[model samples]
Target: MDLQAIRTFCRAVEAGNLTAAAKALHITKSVASRRCQSLEDGLGVKLLARNTKGVTPTDEGALFYERGIRILDDVEDAAQAVKHTSDNLVGTLRFTAPRSFADLKLGPPLMAFAQQHPGLKLEMNLTDERVDIIGGGFDLGLRIAPELSDTSLIARKICDIRHHVVASPAYLEAHGTPKTPEDLKDHNCVFYSNVEAAKQWRFGTGNNARAVRVTGQVTSNSGLMQLAAAVEGVAIATLPDFFLEDAVRDGKVIKLFEDVPRAPSYLYALYPERRLLPLKVRLFIDFMADWFAVPENHCEV
Candidate 1:
């Protein structure tokens, strides 16, 4: 069996389309189609159901892919074990991350890493939604949360992310400032819709912790949009310290509850559970941890 054809089949399945798989593999769509066809012919089985929209794997294809991907991973691991070097990091390094966090904090370090490893191709997909890391064929993911619900993936805590409640001066002036955690319920608050129980905003930690059920005029999944609403005096927004830094510094918004400590969320590097993690992915995660360890990299609330 042709190894390249197997790889193409696997990539096509993950990508949900031949075009995307072809792009990732640095090959033409025609070539990708041909490879998959060759693999199917050799096996005497129809591996793919191709339509104008994309391609879907047949049951046989899925079964083959399940085993083939592991075989490929093991093969790569064996090769890396023999000759591990930065120069050998030749291939796409795909990952996903939250758009706001990646745009705000991950840019510099990611670019620096890319520059350091000229042979490696970095493919980063930024979205605020929780992505299927394994199904998406991503090598890793960056997530910010108090805790992840998905236990299937391996997680490494990279850093603590401080969250802050903030509002525009005008909003506070008109609606009256929330003097305590309880007071938040009396005022309109912006919500991050992506979070479960988004209306229940938590404050403090452990014994003194409070979950304030907040009413909101604006709710959005995007952190930037939430920040905007707060800046525009639509409502108070509790957002990551990084999201509030610029607005607070420019006096567009005022940070509230300075004395009350909010439960800190964490920045985590997540990857699918596998026998051997790719060396490039491991190194990148380490680089992220080292980068964020610097005091200057942290945003002040």
Candidate 2:
């Protein structure tokens, strides 16, 4: 099979149309179509189903694309190994991360990594909205949770993160404090509406774990928004400790249920499963793991 043909076909599949694939590869639509046709002819199988909507891989094409992607990654890794040092790595890495974490904690480390690999092109989308990694063609996804509900993606735990239940003094004074998970239902609570069970607030871990259904005047996808509402005495909120550290220290919010023990959360680097991971992706994962392992960096959050 022609390497260029395989490359073009893979790009077409990812881009969902010949015009998009062609534009991405800096080639004309005719050229991209021809390359894909040549690839199909050489393989003796119809790789793509084309229509007005877009092109999608056939069953056989899906199998071939999966293996083809792995093969291409391996070949690229070999070329990079011969031509460049680890620091001299080059390529575009597109990723999506939660805006709450990215705004507060992700900038320094990401910038440092980019500086260390100046040849690399970084494309990041920071939003609390959940994104489809495969559909979006993202190289990776960064997430924070006690455990990932999505089993489709492979996840590597970069570091541990803590979640705290917090409320302003006035709110607690007015509504009284929640001593147990069950007390949460009686009070107005800020909800992070992005996750699977937005209103279900979890506490503890292992056999003692439980979730409480909560309601409030405020509902937001952003953790920062939830934190702000809690600080302004709107309602109680369960947010990552990174967002609460400053507010708690300043007496704007009081950390509650310290002795109750909530489920542990971790910073995870998530990516799609593949036969062989790309070198750039692997390097970034390792870099993140190492960077967060430091006491200063981890504690800063």
Candidate 3:
């Protein structure tokens, strides 16, 4: 029943000789022998047999030893778990984000952060649905173009997502390319559905920085889908640079009305109010900034 008694008994069984076990346990020979005897008496079982050479375990002693090792292992794990709880940087960080942002901007930085802080755990839920940070027990959310009206939550702007109008070379060849924003009305356009009245894309041009309401034929809820349509020469699509940069570079999609790029949407880290964020979360946000803010990472990689 007592851990100390079990430990002493285990040592005696391992040593085989009472004198050796006594020295190993930092106790006298008589005390060591008495410990084994008391354990057997307490259990009403023969735990050890004394021969001329030394002592060996009975079947009952062998069973207890086997189970005892497992118990000790569990005890060690419990202690480690407690220690981990006390550490601020430890424990699982639950977060949510839009699917596209999670895949493109978040995954690489998060993976790097995980490697840097091996003890920390991260639970990422990728969804476009607006999640209640406090109610859902989330530590943070990577919100793109969010309106920070909630007084209870705080947001840190990490990066800006610039939008661009793109069309495939084939589509531009088939349909006379739009030389300016006014010419967009005649072309087939792809739109992201969540964006209300997406058929009407607003862009700023010239010193006045105006907004042009363009029309689109194909509409999709997913940014990737809009990008795919543009890539496949289906239609001209206006999308965030993050979504179209590769296609533009590879010549799959060509830019139109280069003078009038859409407004840049900010990417923010939203979290519940706290005096000081945990080091893990703080480090993660900083890593996200570093990974994204670098010029080399802009549209190339």
Candidate 4:
């Protein structure tokens, strides 16, 4: 089988037309069409259906495309594996991560990686929204969650993250401190709307666990905004330790209910599952693990 023809067919399926695929592959449309025709003839199956809407993969073609993607990925991974023995690393790494984490924790180490490999280019999309890593053409993603989502991607644990209920000293002074979890109900609580239970904050551990229904002066999807509100003495906020570390260290924010316990979440590095992983992606993952292993690199509660 011709890998080039298979690649061209897959590209055409992804691009939704031969013309688009040709432009992307830097080949003429006639060449792309010829490759697809040759692929279908060799396989004895009509891979694509052409019409006024351009071209679309047939049912069998769609299935073939999926396998083709993995085949191509495996081929590239094999090439990268051989290249791994060299001292120099070169490639573009496109990844996505949460905005707050990127700003506070990820930026430094990733920048150092970029500096170390001058031939490498990094493109990072920092947002809280869950991105379609494969569809979006991202090489890797960093996610912080209590439980991993069911997906085809491979995930490796980076570190454990704990949430802290905090408020400015002035806010606590004026509104009074919450001595217990229940006391939060009486205070103005800033909430991260993106959280699963934005209004319901849980405390303690198994068997003794309890949930508190909280109402606040403000609610937003951004954790940074919630942290800002808490810092300005506007409302109490439950934020990850990484975001509250500097604030607590400077006395800008005070952690509440030191005795109360909150469920701990984890930071994970996610990437597509492949038989032979790329050296660049593997190197980054290793670097992140090492970076987080150093206590000073992460926030301590």
Candidate 5:
């Protein structure tokens, strides 16, 4: 069987139309049609069914397409492995990360990486919403959590992230600082809607630890929004060290409950599990781990 024909068939399945597949492959529609027909004939099966809306693979075609994708991935991995020796990284690296991290921490290191490999293209989607990395065709993801829920993806801890309950000096002065976690109920708190834990702030650790359901005038999915509100004396916010480092240093915000031990969290680099990891993904993970280890970039608790 012709690999090109198999590729064309796979593209058709992805594109959902012969013309679109042909355009993507830079081939004529007739050529695309012939390739699909040839692939079907060689296998002695009907591969696709066409309709006014578009086209869909038959059951047999769907099974074949899955295998075809794996075959193509293997071929690309083999090529990338050989190309690694030349120190030339090409093609696109698509990834997703939290918007707050993307804005504060990812810009510098990722830009430096892109500059080093002029041939590489970086596509990043920064949002608070959790994305389906594999379904979205993302090469890798950066996440901050105490523990990852998806066991299918391989996660490597890049660095430890510390969380703190902080408020602007003015806000604390007006609302009065809480001597303990229980005192938080009397004060208005800024909640991050995206995080489940944000609804209930956890303080201390082990037997002494406690969870408090706090109320706030402002609730937002964006950490930056919560940080801004906290800075303006709106309310107290439980935020990560990376987001509040500059503010705390500048005296814009004051970290509260100095003796309280917050739960442990870490910055994680997550990617789909495979027998042979792609060189680009592996290199990126290593670079980020090293970058975060630098003292200047470290977020000390």
Candidate 6:
């Protein structure tokens, strides 16, 4: 019935005991027990069966528990919304992002956002492996490339990443420049082995994208590794611009077929499906969209 009492009840369920719940909620066990008791009494149902091992939610308790979770979420959302619209949007934004994107650039924008919104806090996780944001307890996520599997989460396309087929200047000179996608077949191509068809490189061919089957003397599942190989003139690599900025800038790799058509991977910001996402999540998504809106965001892989 009461928000605080329901919060206490859910806390007890998550913690498995009144004492632990109080510890988690920074309240006394007596207060925790009182809240849980009041919540159960108001609903006219036994919510928990306390035993020597721990507190377990009963069948009726389980039903109440689900509703209780939503109630707690609403309370948190309300508090965050209030603070968000206030002078400072103060709260922690738990974020996950692709590994390459994080190591290179995510920190600067997030740092700037935090500086502007002094009350905002960020907990960032960077990894190549796709994460389950809801299951992993993340507030939001950043992703690039073809949209992965669809879920209940809300995804916003932030930018388009136009990829490049580049090889080191030396490699181009040694192997000869590839004037077309067919030209790559003659050159030793380094590949991202993790891709479903590493041996089959796709390129724009009229109305339909055509696939080119090739042999690579060197290959690795890691995009970074492939970039390194391409930089050293081992072989030509096709990778997103984000991972090859330095190499491309220094003329280490030469972008080929600039006039030809190419595929573009999209960058996206994702959040849960809840109607009331926390202010932290909402603002973080806005900041990311703004940060990636620059002209140089062309990348593909």
Summarize candidate 5's per-residue lDDT along 1-301 as a digit string, tens digits: 6888887888788667888778756789899999999999999999899888777999999999888878877887889877754368988888899988888888999998888787878989898788766545577899998779978689999999899989998998887888988888899998878776677887777788788878879998888888999999999988888888789889999998878856768999998766567888888898899999998988664
lDDT of 6 by residue, 173-200 (tens): 7788877887777888887755567788
| CA displacement after TM-score superposition, residue 120 of candidate 1 (Å) | 0.4
Candidate order by TM-score, decreasing, is 2, 4, 1, 5, 6, 3
Model 4 steric clash pairs: none
RMSD of 4: 4.4
Q: Residue by residue across 1-301, what tens digits does model 4's lDDT show?
A: 9998998898777657787777656688899899999999999999999987678999999999889888988888777777644357887888899888888888789888887777778889898877766545577899988777747789999998889999998998899988899998899998886668889988877788889999988989888898899999999998998888778889999888778867678899998766667888888898889988998887565
TM-score of 4: 0.81
In terms of lDDT, which candidate is strongest?
1
Please, what is the whole-model Cα lDDT of each candidate in the order they appear? 0.87, 0.85, 0.73, 0.84, 0.84, 0.76
Cα lDDT of candidate 3 equals 0.73
lDDT of 3 by residue, 9-32 (tens): 766665676777676556787987
Model 3, residue 216: distance off in Å is 2.7
Model 2: lDDT of residue 81: 81
Off by over 4 Å in 5: 1-70, 206-209
Candidate 2 local lDDT, residue 222? 81
For model 2, residues 16-84, the per-residue Cα lDDT tens digits are 788877766678889989999999998899999999988999999999999888878788778878866
Query: What's the number of clashes in each of the models?
Result: 0, 0, 0, 0, 0, 4
Query: Each candidate's root-mean-square deviation in Å?
Result: 4.1, 3.0, 18.9, 4.4, 4.9, 6.4
Ranking 2 against 3 by TM-score, winner: 2
TM-score of each: 0.79, 0.86, 0.65, 0.81, 0.78, 0.72
Candidate 4's displacement at residue 110, Å, is 1.0
Ranking by lDDT: 1, 2, 5, 4, 6, 3
